[model samples]
Target: MAHRKWIVWIRRAILLVLLGALVYHSTIVIQIIRFRTINPRMTALMRQRAREARARGQVPKRLQVWLPYERFSPHLVRAVLAGEDPRFFVHHGFDWDQIREAIQENLEEGEIVRGASTITQQLAKNLFLSTSRNPVRKLHEAVITVELEMLLGKRRILELYLNVIEWGDGIYGAEAAARHYFGRSAAQLTPEQAAFLAAIIPNPRETYNPARHPARVERRRRIIQRRMRHVLIPAPFRAASAKAAESAFAP
Candidate 1:
């Protein structure tokens, strides 16, 4: 009986492997047919969340509004890259150097001193997965990050990330965040406002308040300005951005 049970378990394992392979191949074929679409896993999750919200008789609070890359100001994009992911243009989906440094910092501090996610990895997590922190979910994020980067170039990746990332509880995208926070379109957002908006993305739901967190907003704005001066964006754009930033923060 023990021998028969062992053989049965082995057979089940083989069947599971075959099923996994079939699904994997099907996924590849589907992806080939939909190269420009959001990752399938993300679309499914979005639908599931919407369906669950409807089942609970709750309106889904998510607000996603995709815009073309051309709609956003190049300065705003540069500010986001400078603030969030400086190596976005050069790195692949993963930045192992930053990951290693983050791990070391966390170990040394006994707290999360740094984030290990690259822009692509963050985009995958924001679009497809929840805020749950676990090895299994992180592995899935990494896999999907690679797929997204393979299918979309850096420009498209940044554009989609800017458009879909949650800025406040019910606000999403650069356009929405700008309107919600500053009463302006993303194209008209002054550099200080744009920098403050970028600062909030790390913890959008908690960190910012247009009324209450003035000090924190000023500090983050300064950091963004300093970094903006050092890198990203062209020199003329930088000068104009600096001027706008100074004007925005002027009492």
Candidate 2:
């Protein structure tokens, strides 16, 4: 009798867990479908940052300006592609090759120093999820990423990412980053400036911050500039980038 009761309890627990997962993912699907037409006014990271600032007794400041896809410079687009996701245009919502490489590197180094997230995955996490690396959050991010790809195309995804990604302590989006870092608009950023900004995307507040580590940022900027020549933005954007950038570096 006790054995049967134990099995019944286990079955009920499994059903409850499955039911909770269904409800969670169903809500995510509804939100993602709405994202097809609705531009997000704010993102999960913004809210998280605000709460953190409040807990620390520091006022939260946000700098963000939403611009349509065409308003940002093509050079910035190229630089971002070079620095963050070189195969963004080809991949769906994930990059298996990158995952394999990152896994191999982690094994060799005996540490987790690299990430394999695609731009689409990053956008999904920033838009709707927290920065935590917990398994539940990662699973939710995966679901959101798939839904985002199913609902929004590559161009729209890129535009939303460019507008929502955190570039600094209070800076969000290309326009705000440009204004804060270089005293210019997103549309007017030069290739080198754009490259510098892009190189800091992985960790804008510390490792690659120009204020704290200009030398590291500069090295990454040069590497990105070289990669920019080969990186291609998704259409309907033109390909006439980086060639003009070559002149900027001519000595």
Candidate 3:
């Protein structure tokens, strides 16, 4: 009788959990629909960081400017794709090859030494999730990424990512990063400048200023620049490349 009672309770708990998950996911789907056209003013990650800063008795100010996709330099776009997600244009959301490799490396190292987050996955995490490394959080990120890819086109996804990703302690977006680092607009960034920005993205908080770690940043920047020459920019962004080139020459 006790065994049957325990089994009943377990079934009840599972149903409740499934119901909760369904409700939560429905809300996320609604939000994704809204974001298809509207630019987000702030993201969950940014708000979480702000709350932590306030708890520590420090004020956090985010420096960000929203620029249309055409306003950004082509070199910056290509360099970022080269450094972070070479398969961004090709993959649906996840990179299976990278995922398999990362899984093997993590098993051997007994810890996560590598990540296989595609640009879409990274954007999903930045927009809607916390920085917690847990199975639940990763699942949520994956779900949101699929929703983003389905609701918005590739160009919009890349634009949202560039405008919301952290570039420094307080700097957000390509425009802010360009002005903060190179004293130029995102449209005006040189190939070298763009490559340097892309190199520090993986550790933006620590390597915010490329000048501070010239050797490390330079090495990564060179690698990205070399890759940029051959890496394919998605077709949607190709038209902007000519505009980006013109802006690079602007006085």
CA lDDT, every model vs. true structure: 0.68, 0.83, 0.82
Compared with the true structure, model 1 gives a TM-score of 0.73
Summarize candidate 1's per-residue lDDT along 1-251 as a digit string, tens digits: 99999999999999998898568646744663374665233343355556767898999766655666666755577678766776777788887777786688658855342357888888777766777789867876877787878877776777778887778766768888888777878877666777788767676655555456666656666666666554454343243334554444345
Candidate 2 lDDT trough over 10 residues, lowest sum = 238-247
Model 3 scores a TM of 0.88
Cα lDDT of model 3 by residue, 1-251, tens digit: 99999999999999999999889889988988888899998898789879988998999879999999888888888888877777888889999987887678658855333457889999998999988999999998988999988988888899999999988887889999999988989988788998888888877776435657677667777767776776677566764566554354345
lDDT by residue for model 2 over 12-86, one digit each (tens)? 999999999899878878877777778788899999999999999999989999877777878898888777777
Number of the candidate with higher lDDT, 1 or 2: 2
Q: Which 10 consecutive residues of model 1 have the lowest summed lDDT?
A: 233-242
Q: Candidate 2, which segments miss by more than 4 Å at Cα? A: 101-115, 239-251
As for TM-score, the candidate ahead, 1 or 2, is 2
Order of the predicted models by lDDT, top scorer first: 2, 3, 1
